[model samples]
Target: MPETPPRARALETDTIRRLPKVLLHDHLDGGVRPGTVLELSHEQGYAALPAEDVDALSAWFAQAADSGSLARYLETFAHTVGVTQTAAALTRVARECVLDLAADGVVYAEVRYAPEQHLEGGLSLDEVVRAVNQGLREGEEEMTALAGPDRGQAAPAGPIRVRAILTAMRHAARSREIAELAVRHREAEVCGFDIAGAEDGFPPTRHLAAFEFLRQENSHFTIHAGEAFGLPSIWEAVQLCGAERLGHGIRIVDDITVDGRPVTDDLASAIARSRTEPEAFALGPLAGYVRDRRIALEMCPSSNVQTGAAPSIEKHAITLLTQLMFRVTLNTDNRLMSATSMSREAQLLVDRAGWTWTDLRRVTVNAMKSAFLPFDERLRIIEDVLKPAYDD
Candidate 1:
């Protein structure tokens, strides 16, 4: 093998961690710190955790979720969601999530959680949203203060802004209610709505009422599609439900081909062939629609690998999607479960997939563009914060 070219070489770990990032698909219940889970479980008197000690519990979550089945990977959320059932627990988890992301150099994030999952503590859905919002606000203030007088331009760590995307479990029946809740709090830190769960049987069409309501009210939403399922799910999400973005849309590769042959199983070969002969690759109608419309694919490499959506970082469809300019954005779907952060995801692509600084910067810009934020705010962050920071 030949030595790697300098331009394509991976950036240093510390340098990657210091670069600013934007995250669009992160889960609140999926990212609770193990220590927080233990403490909260103790405080709430819930003892169903698989492990008692912090380290053991952390390892358990990572291991349990590493199973190469999406259904099995979702089982790890029980302990995390089990512990955070009250306002205080939810608030603490949300605040810590922001701080952790800030430390990992995520300047902007839209953290999501199913509101119905946290209501078992007897709190109403409204209260659940309020508790999480309170925590997000507190975290934002703390990050801002940490940035000090210069507003983080001169500091080692910069300020972070975290917004909420209210999620409704797709298997449940409260999607319309959750959509209404999200629209109600749209001005109070809640940025959007989503439906997430196993996507096999519970199709996006099942929640048609909720999507229709959101669109009628002029609210933004994304659908969890094309991860465990295939193109039909994505077709319904885009054509039927009007999803603003796709949550883990890696399976869209099922609709792509190279030289008239499907590239689902032989993605690495297809990618290599495309590099030498770009004209050999072709996108089917659904893929063309998604790409032409710039529907952002919130691709989480490690999480997708753990759930067997992709083989590995090097062979992940994200690299091919990025090469094809498919409006791809990097994300850490579950920080605790995947043992990953924004920086870690970027570093993996750089090291395993030979992505460069330009690649990282492009994805970051793509995320900001696809963000549910108002146009001016998105432009301000991209022009003022993201561009300046990446330029350095």
Candidate 2:
């Protein structure tokens, strides 16, 4: 029997989980707990769930999300959004979102959702934002309290801070309205803005008004691009609309071409090739600008595979981007739908792409620097929190 390739190596499954992580592109409604979904359906008198058993319900969602179509994958959210129509449901889900990420060792996260979707229960848009913010506040408090003495050192050091990103669905027409809402709450809990939905025909340009509004307000925003689509979509998102970061920008790999495969499959040298030579690789204008400009690619590995953006973890473009030294950040786009975490995404890279701990630390730092928070705050967390955790 032949020896397995180095790309086949995997760290201890728990090792990645112990590292402090940051999340940038998580969705609020899409990450509802399966058990909670069942309970919420019962509480809200919404009886449309396909499965009653907890494991079966989870399996059903995973299977539904496995469809290679982005539109089909998005359809799985109807049940989650259906039950989250009320303030109470929204609050509970947001609270759980914070606590769950804290337990997974995430120190910072920006969770996003569309306010327009939650208005089906007759709540005003302002009311929806306030409810979600209140839940985030309470969830942060709850996580701190739980970490007091019972969990001891198992708890993540320092408090887990969360901020909200107001998202407008691209297939809809209320982006300008949502941009105003985000600005209104900017000083409150809302940290930034975003536009999300299927990307085939509904380009980010459809929400240009919103992007311009945010830009004038001196606010930050991320656009969902280059996942189900290609480099053209990414170009529109970054060049035309001025996105600060790209959500699931895995397709940026389309802009990159290699002269020759690395003689060794290890990730370290692959990254060295990116920093050293132009002749060894070809970066199209779009990719070169994205790299040179420090525009972060919010790469979601497992979710990309689930959405058919990439065929498998082994073949995902993140490996190439990391090797090419592009500004890459790992994320779990929809924790429930993709059934992944930041740690799991990093671990998959280690197991399938031969990523090293240095690669993990670099990506984590890339995420911290690209965080939507103010510069001083991002610096504080990086210098005080992240460096200390990973430096050891």
Candidate 3:
């Protein structure tokens, strides 16, 4: 891989932070503010935090999640989820998530969390959804008010439209219930349904009934696949379970062979070579289907690296998939756990992966296109907000 050019290297972090972005796969619990977590823990009397100081807790969460194992990476969420058992905690976290994304120039985001996981405070699933939606709405309003009338023109921090994606834990049996909850709250900030958890033994087919119910209700959904697991997980999510977009679908690279051999090393070079020597690369049936159908792949660089899904940011499959013209969208899966934001993700891609502004814009556009938003709203953001921001 070539070094990032001097001009690109000289790109200011503020410039990247100011770029309008669309996020499709952020987690609500996974993005709690460290200070918020500490305060909430104190308020809730939950004393399980490994660190008392805010900075220490923040560092602890980052370090714990950086352990190259998805399962271990997920364990850090217990603290975030632990404190967010009540309506207020959930609302605060959700609201802060929107504001943080807005501050980072995320124009649109679909933040997801499993309602069932937050019911320990005696709140029902419906109540959990309502609380989160309330927070998201409040956050959007606050962001818009802060941006003022000039908004995108005068303020680099523009208002962000954040919706909720109700998730069902794959290891749990509440998928159908969550899907119904998502459909019920569709007009009230909830946009879609998803099944997320360890993707190893529990296939998305386990939640087939939920997907079928969602399809019958004319609802949208995405499945967590191809992150911790492999191609079979992705294949089942798309072919069998009908995922609209793939959460961390970086594993689709498994279906592509470069030079008639499996991609084993230097994925950056192989992808670059494939671009110039198209004949040297071949996509398997599943890969072709994903690309041909334009199923969006929500690829999170930092999270993927931390989860051992990809070797590193520079060698991540997102760049390869982008080169192959797959529907690829960059994301920050867990802002707290991965210690990332949309800008940070883009910065890593630009600095480490040799991505240009055009690449960032293309993926941002792809994200907005793939979002579970109304068609007219999606088109409006693409035409009015995203394109103009990047074109500037």
Question: Clashes in model 3: which pairs?
Answer: none
lDDT of 3 by residue, 202-293 (tens): 99999999999999999999999999999999999999999989999988988899867776456867867855676677899999999999
User: Which lDDT tens digits does candidate 2 get at residues 1-392?
Assistant: 88533224345566567678889989998899999999999988898999997999999998999988899999999999999998988899999999888878888999999999999999999999999998999999987777655676545554698999999999999999999999999887799999999899999998898899889999889999998888889999999999999998887766666664532244345445654564587787898899999999998888888888887787677877876788899899999998777778888888887778777878888998999898899999889888876665
Model 2, position 331, has a per-residue lDDT of: 90
lDDT of 1 at 103: 86
CA-lDDT, candidates in order: 0.90, 0.85, 0.89
Model 2 lDDT at residue 250: 81
| Residue 303 shift from truth in candidate 1, angstroms | 0.5
Top-down lDDT ranking:
1, 3, 2
Instruction: Return the lDDT, model 3, position 138.
Output: 93
Candidate number with greatest lDDT: 1
Q: Which parts of model 1 are misplaced by more than 4 Å?
A: 1-10, 149-157
RMSD of each: 3.6, 5.2, 3.7
Q: Candidate 2, which segments miss by more than 4 Å at Cα?
A: 1-10, 148-150, 260-279
Model 2, residue 197: distance off in Å is 0.6
Which ten residues in a row are the worst by lDDT in model 1? 148-157
Question: Between which residue pairs do clashes occur in model 1?
Answer: none
